[model samples]
Target: MQARAAQDLKARMTDALVEAGLTYAGAVAHHTPRRLVLSVQGLLDQSPTLREERKGPRVDAPEKAVEGFLRGAGIDRSQLQERDDKKGRVYFAVIEHPGRPAAEIIAETLENVVRNFPWPKSMRWGAGSLKWVRPLHSILCILTADSGEAQVVPLDIDGIKAGDTTYGHRFMAPDGFAVTSYDDYTAKMRRARVMLDADERAGHIWQEAQNIAFSQGLEVVEDKGLLAEVAGLVEWPVTLMGEIDEEFLDLPPEVLQTSMKEHQKFFSVRNVQNGDSAGGIVRFITVANIETPDHGATILAGNQKVLSARLADAKFFWENDLRIVRDKGLTGMAEGLSDVTFHRKLGSQADRVARITALAREIAPMVGAKPDLAAEAAQICKADLQSEMVGEFPELQGVMGRYYAQAAGHDDGVPEACEMHYKPLGPGDTVPTEPVSVAVALADKIDTLTGFWAIDEKPTGSKDPYALRRAALGVIRLVLANGLRVELASTLVRPYHQNIRAALERHGAIPAEELNLPELSFDKVGLVERYQESKEGGTEDVPAVDDLLAFFHDRLKVHLRDEGIRHDVIDACLAMDGNDDLTLLVKRAEALAEFLKTDDGENLLQGFKRANNILTQAEEKDGVEYSFGADVKFAEVEEERALFDALKAADGAIKPAMEAEDFAAAMAAMAALRPAVDAFFEAVQVNAENPVVRRNRLNLLGQIRGICLAVADLTRVEG
Candidate 1:
């Protein structure tokens, strides 16, 4: 995160400074909580004076256009000269800009950067029109030459003026002092209890936290994000360790940790003797701004006092929730979900839960989970969303459900399923391996994809408000990691039909107009009510199950794009059958991707494209397809006859290879045809004088297309 932010700051400040007329070799931007500092090196005393040629509109063009150009360039009719151009004679002007001192340029640039800083949010302070993210503070601008002589760059903004003096460590060393140069300023700040660099502060905070936890035989729960945030809050870092009361320790470790980190910006200390995070968290650590004579004891005590109150509330919620879970059961906790809308048209969370439960039950056997166990996991997986513990901490929604499920005396794996179903929240997140977890996880993601697809709420470009891309990738990783052989299109149809019916009942019509798929028989969708009896089945051909299936291919394409398999390769395989079975599709894509990188594959692709091009033009010109009945008798050249023999051999080898899903073997078979195809293209001409012979050669080319496509759809693979 800091890396990207630093890069953006460097680029923005560089461009802004250059535009403001400061000349330098380069500039680097460093960020801390209190400041964004740009250290520019190899700076000239002043920007180089520029002599530029400016142009005006054509001489015969509109008067207003020429006048506007002149006015914008700050030139007059006397300064303009006539020049010859393609359209006509045009007016040109020479402009001279005298350079200003680097200090003056820098001061002006800094003022503008501060005044109109591109913060996502800013505020006006003390009635000034200029806005800033924070209140006005001192500006310390300086310019130094190679000889080591330094001058304080003059700047004055909103009544605050630049000076050689800057204060440090708001509490510990708040007094201001003067300095001569960058080196002097940093050394002074360090001595005054301020760590000038954010990284240094972060290192000190983390090392101290770890040491404090280690002395107590526990480890600091590593939250890089929380560490970075807390590091920004102080300059003189004082890491303080505090204890959680024994009563609150009975609450889930996640609860205790999350409460401390979220509310108080403290890091949790965990006793992970078994090398699992599930090992309970035992204590907490917070930071102080300064050191005291009595050390951090007073600070730790005050922090614990505040932390205990927060944990007391959490304990109350946990106990009350466990009581609700035991008395009312998971279903009782989930009762409020029916009223909570998941989407306006897709019904409530209760409706979504019911759909997920159905899908999970159907998917359980395929993923090696017991149907009953998968069904039970899916039913109550989201029950904690209604719990007070989850209400207070939404980030722990699935996690708290696991605790509640265990407390309710459900099966051991059921609780794990509740927590792990949301596994792999992102690219770096882990995919769950347990069967019940896999079943519920797949069901949950698949339902989201199909439901949104049914409503035509598919992601467009970068705007995936639903994070359907992550959902699809999650499904892909889960299936591939577990080696599940589920066909996605057939799997998604039941839920798609359910969504269509639900939407129809709610809004009285199927949203066929919004879907960009095959034909949808919206008027006849009523027939889906008697799904078993419906002759055509409840599925629509338009925006058919195939369309949503296409969406998964796109998501899968994004997921595998960085794995060296090109988009065209994924697209080629997506064009084939069983593309809905992502594992098979990806395997084919990977093999084909590897093949295309080889000499044999490259030659084969060219040969195939050449054959396809000839065949396509012939069929279009003749208004007839010359499909695969190429006869060796009509082949007038050895090359054509050799291709005929190769096609037969390839056709024989490719079929069984594809049947076994051995794409590497199939591609090898196809690759053997490349020599014959290249020789044929070189020797044989498809548009022969004899119409019969011409038809035979075109058909031979068609055979090449057919053979190549048999491995994977090579037509979609670009040259």
Candidate 2:
């Protein structure tokens, strides 16, 4: 009964709109939300008249065309008003316009009605000169019954008129019928087997896919982007399960998945037990636009045929790639590496791999990896570049190499390293956990960074074409997450110099004799000295290692800032020497930040600041500087003796705590000195009349400086 009433109301609304010279577009009724949204397109075609009493001519120079366009759109002339130009575009405004529609309907109307306006990038095809993102098609305009019973809103664009009816899916739903309201329209469309909203269709597909996977004790790899695109291409989704040809199963699973996704848009399914098998039994699920009467047999067959052809190409590449691998023994793969450019300025992949191997060897001990194994892993991490599977699917570079390396009977770590090296590619990605893999991954990232920096190819303003920023972040995560103690500068500088030297040698620009000289030779020394001078002068001319370290430090702050560490804490930790051990540096920073939250830490900082300020003033005022011999005999107050004893105890405790990597313990030990420090300040004056006593006080302040500097450069900390 409600449906019939809605239908009757929709017919009456359509009739009224036609009589009033209006048009209708599309409409939707949401059930869960219990709302009716009527999408009417073309109401903006109306125009209003201008009055001579308001100003001069109703439409002036430059806006006459727009006024004429509005007049042709059916807008009343009396309500036309001109407004100020804000966007520098000449446009007239409508004031006190009587034909008002819902906000949603008006927004839709503006989009659909302005078809023939001159857009910056537009096309005119077939017969008309209408311009749009694509060619103009039929406009969907509709009106709901809830607005009013007798009223009709005018909506017209070009010559298309609004109606209260719409069609569904092209094949499954070919017929259109009248609808008196949005509710009736949605119901009829649903009955006709159509999902009007793209998101609804996507949700249905994913839910069905998950159901299928769950029934078989498997999981669906839900790709939101793929789901959205597929949803747009269909109206009604019907998932069909199919199988690849048994022969094609010999191809790597990644290859199979990539081929199906790229060429056929099919989702690859994995066997419940065989997660890593390349040639294991694989099932593919496909989403079709219709539910055929044949239960999707014909669709499945058609898809299987298409997939067979794609798999054949993949098989050919796999077989052919093995032949190349056998002949090349990894070196054959390196042949095309030169052509596979790392970056236009960073040379080839082979060159990069070589540099990476060198760096990995150097960084191995720092991360507790066997140097030889680290070098070996780095050398072949990119060997998959020679594989046909990787060539077909670039995203599967590391994954494909693992399979090929295993096939070649290489060490298990070698293949695993290949897979792990490009890891932590994103925020949620895992860092290489194994010692060998971590070493190689760090090496690979560092080499890329140093190479790019050497060529002055650093990232600028959102333009990091080389992914240098990600690589830097990966390096930080790998070190900190794995608790490695690598010196970033030592590891980065050698590779940087090596790459620079290689470039010079390749062009025959530098003499062979000069190249053979030690790294610290005259030429290298001169370069280092020049860099140091620039740095001292506050210029951006530091060595690549120093600059890269600074960049890494910035990346570290970004990484740790989210963990709630104060910016000052990071600065203080980084200002200390031996900060290249990123894991240790972060540990120290985190401990110190937590300690600073305590009352003892707060008072210690205050006392330290006070002592530092007074000492600085005295040093500046007095010509003579104080030295470190505190005269025990001249100690006039017990507070001074207590402070001296506290300093000795803190020095003894903090040194070992830091050496043991117990930063929390070190901070606690430093915290203990606060009370003694406060007492000394309260009980004694540093600027005493006796020269010996003043010197002793100055030395005590210097002792505080030394102790604080032991843990971190407290001077760099902000109050």
Candidate 3:
């Protein structure tokens, strides 16, 4: 009975397998062994080891079917994967299934699983109920065995059944037939003149293009972006050389290059030996979409015609600009400046130029340039805004103005300054070493910074819309790189305060009279009073000029840190009053850093710290301040009297040394007192039995602190 039951099951399974299109071929001849071999090409009938049933309305989703088939196969979820949409069909993986063939089960599952499939965005078309990127198409499914025959997998999507064939490019290929293996499928596609791998085709195009350029003694400015884009646009790539019309060669090379790259996607080629020649012609490497019989002559001509029109427009703009320069003085070019907004809150370009001119006049003498020339340079710096060439290409801002100024017969320095003012625009950019250019450039940047600061638009964190941080760094590079002895605070503070006052007046935020302060010299006490009053009455939201000066000191530390200067050294130097002069501040910081590397300097700092700590502790504990002079008469011990004498000598030497800006000499003189300081601390007892002596000792420590701090804040030195 069991035998009969097994036979019945086997017959039913064999019938089902035959209906599913499985075939069996046995006793194939083995030529080498002279023997017959059994060949099987069909599903094995057995009780199902894994069973999963998915019930849904009629569906056609390949991905859904793939999921159910993998689940029913007891396959790991990690083994199943989905990839990007191909043409209009979604692709998915199906793992091994028991009882039924893997591909067959996947095909059957898809028909039932896709009825309730969801799509983020989908469309329905034609006379079918199925939805897809386009209408449903044929399914390609096959399961191959180690022997030879492919187990037929039946599937239908909108009445389209699974098959084992795929065609190549329609125009280049025509014949199509069944594919027994993936290798056979790829081989057939290749034989039909199709590149199955996109990267291989791209590599061929690049190598050929490079070879052609190298053979001609020219270089192809290979743009990877253009190459990738062109690769996508073509099934086959063929490189061709094209020539530019000589008439269009008069345009700037940058213009020619931009036109060719933007409009035609042509690679610009340069002659190998034309490095020093301005008249060298531009060779364009054209990438052709097809290998044409005429070698892409038609394509080249079409591209050249478009490029010629672009260059002609550039030439027209160039000529029109030269004519405008001849008709009007560069100053007269300000008529168009109204249209160019400098900043949303900072008025027009003309207005910015006016402010910069005012600043240049104030800053010129410090950089050793005549005020008149600096002011003139700043006035017309933005005048190129009126030029047609600059209007077309904004990058030619200062460059166009220089040409116009020279054409108008302005001073030689004026024209040069106009071009030089926007320099050091980036890290690799050259600084304006010329005195007039340096003065004007500093003025322009300072005006931008102060103007922005006045309007409360200072840079915070990484959000500098105005690029004030770059401007500030440019100012630092200009001053330090040129060895200019300009005071950043003196240059920035007055202009900054004035702009803030102006902005306040313009907005009716403050009374005009409230901002009016008497002009007093830096040495005058009235100057401090006037500046304090301005701080109190200036824009309520904006920080004071004093606060801005502090900000500059902070920026100076940041700037010097990269140059190997210590932050503590910068702090020590800046602690002195009137250290606002950046050049002097930097010199002092540098000198102090060099000095601190020495034994005397190191030991002196340690001594000074010890003295300071003791004095501070004494003052706090006694509830008494000791910021007074130490009388020589109160010195009882020999060491105390010796320290007093040393202090007098050192103070006299240091005063003259610092006045001469000989900070090293001043530090040297201070070092002379180290021994005396050590002796005094060793010999004398502070908080002694005698009140006057103890008070006197405390005052002596305070005096040493004061003298050392006068050179620099020694307390800032890290031991």
Candidate 4:
């Protein structure tokens, strides 16, 4: 945020300079929490004079038009110049602007930038019109020349004036000092016990903390985000390490770490040799902005007291939650979820959990997981949402679930699945590889997507209130990363039907049976009947399942775009049969993506396009498709006969290869036809004078289109 403030200053300053007809080479900034310092480099002393010519009405045009031109130009008719033109003659006016001094321009620019600065939050004080993130303290603006002469730019806003003096380290160096240049200002700031660079302050804090921890056998858990934030909060950092009280040491390491990091802004320290299982979190490192005579002994004492109190609360929550889990198990605790509304339109959290449980069992066999295990894992995965520990730290929802599951004596991947099912919370997060975890994870995300889509709550233009996009991407990653061959068109149907049925039952004025809605079931055979029937009837009662599938396709394109696979290539694969199978779709896209990079594939694309163009035009003209009856005996040239033989061979190889989902082999077969197709187009005229010969060549071109499309829709592939 400090860096963004500096950038905002630079951009506004640059715009002001442009408005004043002045220019600067560049800008440099050093931002601290309390101050933003920017230096404009290589600025012109004054703006250049501008000369412009303005065109006017024809000389012989209406008198009113001529008068209006002169009035708009702020010039007299005598100042106009007559110029010869094709349409007789025209009038022109010359306009010139005088230059303004750089000092004058800088003053106006700085004042405007300060007055209109964009802050995430700002306040006004002392009945002043000026608003700032903090109180307006001082302004230091100076222009240094090559000869070592410096002059302060004239600026004043709301009783604050620009000067060459600046104060540092509010408490330590309360006195103001003068500076002549940027280098001199920074050097003096260092002497005042102020660090001008945030990165330098962070580096100092980390290195000192590590050195202190290394003297013992402990290491600080690295959190760059916390480091940067702590760095921004201090102008001069002093590192101090403290030991946690022994009473709270036996608590979960995450509980200890989260308590310290969240409440005290301290970094957790753990024994490097013993790890979490043995040593646990024994210490914490804190950064203070000032050094006392006792070397932070007084500061550490106060912080330790506050930390112990916070950890005491955490310990109570943890013990209380564990006791509840031991007495009732996760299921008994999850009974409260029925009271928690997941969404007003789509029933409660318990209803959603039911849909996910059924979906997980249905998807278990496909992902190599036992139906009972997957269903059980899904049933209790979200049970900890009601726990006191999770209520205190919302980020530890799944993490706490894992611990409670273990306490409940659930095994066979159930304990791990409680935590791992929410795996891949982001793009950089790891994907779960366990079969039971994959089934539950896929079920969780699919239910979320289908539920929102059923309620007509689809994301629109930078607004996804439901996080549906992230859920869709999660589904895509789970399917592709696990190599799960899920036909999503059918997998999505059962949950979508359930989501619709549940929503209707909750809020519908009419019963579902009155509207001809079928009962929601997990029957594997013809599972898509409910979803498909609604779509085929073109009713607004339920959203199209294909629309949700297409959303997954959209996310897949974004997911593969970083792998250098083009959108059109994924579109080509998407246009083919069985596009609902994300694994197969990506495999074909990857193969075709690699093929299009090779010489054979590139040339084959051109040949296929050429044949398709000719065949389409002929079909349009003849009012019939030339898809069959291309007899080898009717070939009028050797090139035509050779092309027919190549198509036949490619078809023979590609059919079986595509059936086996061996996309590489199918693409290779398609590449073999490039040479024959190219040679035939070169030797034989597709639009021959003889009708029978022309029809035969058109049918042969149709053969090229058919065989090439068998691998992927070449028409969707762009050059």
Candidate 5:
């Protein structure tokens, strides 16, 4: 809490100072359980005086406008100077403001920081209407000069006035001390048995804990987060390691760790040789505020007694859960999920599991998994949610399920899936490598995205309560990492359509007279048949598969942006056929992205743009498209004849490469026509004097546009 307080204070104070126009060279903030401190170095004494001229109405404007301008600028007519304006001569009012001392700004900024500090939650004390993380214990406000003179800034808020004195640790040194500078204050704090720096205190705890644990041939579990939190709980940290009770040692190591950490703010000390076994961790460590007379032996005993009681409760929960696992297996443990509501709009956890199971079964063969194994894994992965162990320790949800699955005589792949299906929870997390885990994992995330999108609950702006973006990223990693050739749109279209129907029926979005489910179309742009007349003659409810596909494309763009693929490049590929096949779309995008980096590709793009622009204008003006064969005989110039031959040759190469989905080869073939295109543009006048030649040249430009677009829509590829 103190660390968080320190961080909050630093950011808030910095913002306040900057807002108050008091820029500084450097600033640092520190906190302990009792207080927060901030020090600024080389802060400007005052904001610089601002001076500028305010423009007014034109010199020849009406008298009313001149009066309003004088009033707005706070100037008399005599003070206005004539200046040339866009329309006519305008009056300019000279404006000047003087700077104030930094001390004055600091006082006001500090008061605002104190009264309006965002403490997450705060409270009022005495009769004052002020709230803080705690009571505004004491305020240490000072300004030290290079001449060794220190002055206290006048600040009083909510009965707490500014002072030069602050007390150290409440128990060790309760006396207050006056300080002339930040350096003097910190030196006194260290001597008074208080460490003002949170990192310093945390480092002391961790280093001492390791040294002591090493003395006993055991190692403390490294938890930097827990260390930081524990450091915040005390002013002067005294690290102590305690032994666990022999009776409670038989409990699961995770149960032991969770019980100690959650209930007592303790760290587990593990015997490395016996790792993962029940008795692997035989000791626990705790940080105390003050050093005891017996060198922490008494503190160790008291903490161990409390830890034993906590572990006893954990052991009871563990054994009871183990009995259920052995007798009924993971399947029986998860039966309670039917009664648990996953969402009010969606169905129960059991309902989601069924959907995932069915989806996994369908997706298994595509990802190289046996359908039966993938189906079984999905059924049992979430079983731990119903276990008593997980009920007490929710962080161990997937972890405990793995243990129970193993106990239920399931194969390694099934148990592995039980724990690994939630892999790659974020971008930094690892994607599961096992084929069954991959299949089940993809199914789980895809079902989440599809189910929520069906209900139109997709994330907007920054709000993603369902973590749909992470799920989409997880799906991307699962596909790309494994090189799976799955069509994400086809995979999403069917189940997503079903889910849309279910969600629509559940939400009552459709007309009550009768349900009219539209046919799904995967061979084209949309997943659902759109623009259908309602039974009563309006619009009907159908899956928003196209919108959802676009959403996935947006996510995929974000995922690939770091790889140097531009959004316009992805948009160009998305505009083409087979965009539903994400693997194919990305493959084409990656190839096109690389190709566009070359001189040949760049020139070809310019040529294609030239052809497209002319064709678009000509078609709109003539009210007819020039998308047909170009006759070489009609070409009056050698450049036009050479382009015709280049077009035919490029057509032969791009056709087979595109047919085979070899985008690189097709892009290369298309690029080879750049010289022919450049030569034609340089030599031939496209709008020739003769009508036949003009018509033939327009058709040739049309062929250039058509052939290049066949590779990837170059119209969307930005210059």
Candidate 6:
């Protein structure tokens, strides 16, 4: 919030200055915990005077129009100049704008900025109408001249006048200090026991903490976010290391780190030799704003007392959750999930888990995982949601699940899968490499996408309340990164049909056993037909799986485009069959993208487009499709006969290469025809005077179109 507020201040001030017709070379904002400072360099003393020519209506235009133009230009008819336009004579008005002094504009802009600053939360105190993030103490507004003279900008806001004075270190140095410029101000702030830059403060805190920990043969567990927050909380930082109670050292390292950081703003210290193997978080470091007479010994005593109470509560939750996991396995702990609703349209969390389990089992063989293990892992991945430990710290959901699964003595992969399945949460995050984890992860994301898509609750524009876009991207990443060949067209149908059936059953719109529905195809038309056969309702109830598949294609385009593959290349590949297999689709797109960069591939594309255009136009004009039967006997030119032989040889190679999914080889074979096709078009005319020759030439173009389209829809490839 502080950083954003500082940025907003800079932007708003710059806009105001520009509006006042003043120009500055550059501006910068400095954000600290208690202050936002803005400095503009190379500021102009005053704006330049402006002279503008305003065009008005023609001389013959309506009287009312001419009068309105004159009034808008703020000029009389005597001052207007007449010019001969192409249409008729026109009027032009010369207007001049006077500039204002910089000091006057700066005073007004500063007052306005202070009065209307944007804050996430603000408070009013002492019967003052002015609201601020906290009680306003003082304002520092100074203009330093090039001659090293400092002058305060004249302004008053809510009875507080602007000045060039600032105080620092509320406890250590409460006296106010005045400075001439930014450099002097920062130097004096340091002497006053304050740090002016947030980044510098963070760096200092981290280095001192690390040095203290290393001196004791320990290392600080680094958390950048916590370091930043602690830096913001102090101006003069004094790092102190303290011991943790041995009673709580047996807890998990993550739990200890999370507890200390979240509750106390403390950095965990780990033993260098032990690491995080068993119990490594034996000490913690805290930052204070002032130096103490006794070197923070009394402060550590007080903080340790408070920290012990917080850890006692954490210990209680951990012991209670473990006792339940010991009494009943993780599955038994998850039995209550049936009462927890996943969504209003969707069923309970238990219902979602069931769908994921089934999908995981179905996807197991394709991803090279055992069906039983994948199913078992998916069944209990969310069991930790019901544990007491997770209730207090929700971010520890999957972390606790892994521990509980291990305690339950599940398989090696199952325990790991419990935690790893939620991974790749972002583009920077890692995806699971274990087979069981991969199967469960894919199943989880696919079910989310299809289920929401089934209920007509798809994401619209930027409002993805259900994160459907992330789920789709997750599926794409999982497939492409793992080189998996599971076809999404079929994989998405079963879960979608299940969601539709569940919704219908909940509404009593269809009887469960009476439906006896067949497997719905990936296309929406097939789903509509299946629904019509079962009931009289319209297609509105049918899930648009084809549209969902298109959504996946859109996300895949974005994903591949980030890797330097063009969107048009992806669109060309999407036009082909088996685009549902993202791995195959991306491989073909990558090969085609590489191919388009070459001279042969570029010439081939042009030739294919030329042939396709001629064939399309001939078919439209003649009202007949000439798709085949291009006889070499009617070629009439040597280039035409060579193209015929080249087409045959290319077809033999491309067919097998395409079958083997060697897209590079297929593209290479297609590129070999570029010279032949270009020569034929260059030497022969398709619309010949002889009727049979013209028909044969058109048929030859059709062959070119067919062969190129077989590799990929080159017609969709853009220049």
Q: Name the candidate, 1 or 4, with the larger TM-score value.
A: 4
Worst 10 residues of 6 by lDDT: 519-528
TM-score of each: 0.89, 0.75, 0.61, 0.93, 0.84, 0.89
Best-fitting candidate, scored by lDDT:
4
| Clash list (residue pairs), candidate 4 | none
Candidate 4, residues 294-318, lDDT tens digits: the string is 9999999999999999999999999
lDDT of 5 at 644: 92
Please give the CA lDDT of all the candidate structures. Answer: 0.81, 0.70, 0.69, 0.86, 0.83, 0.85
Candidate 5 Cα errors over 4 Å, as ranges: 1-23, 44-102, 202-224, 246-250, 269-283, 499-514, 518-541, 633-638
Q: Pick the candidate with the highest TM-score.
A: 4
Ranking by lDDT: 4, 6, 5, 1, 2, 3
Score candidate 2 by TM-score against the native: 0.75
lDDT of 5 at 264: 94
Residue-level lDDT tens digits of model 5 in 485-511: 776765555445554454457457544
- What is the per-residue lDDT of model 1 for residues 198-282, given as tens digits with 9 covering 90 to 100? 8888999999998887787788989999988988788788988878888777778889889998999999988866676567878
Error of 4 at 175 (Å): 1.3
- Candidate scoring better on TM-score of 1 and 5: 1
Q: Write the per-residue lDDT of candidate 6 for residues 637-673, one digit (tens) a residue.
A: 7999999999999999999999999999999999999
What overall lDDT, based on C-alpha atoms, would model 1 receive against the true structure? 0.81
Clashing pairs in 3: 59-115
For candidate 4, what is the TM-score?
Answer: 0.93
Flag the better candidate by TM-score, 2 or 5.
5
Q: Clashing residue pairs, candidate 1?
A: 517-543, 518-542, 518-543, 519-542
| Residue 21 accuracy (lDDT) in model 1 | 71
Tens digit per residue, CA lDDT, model 2, 604-716: 88887887777778778886554366656678899988888899999999999988999999999999999899888888998888888888888888788678778887776
The better candidate by lDDT, 1 or 5, is 5
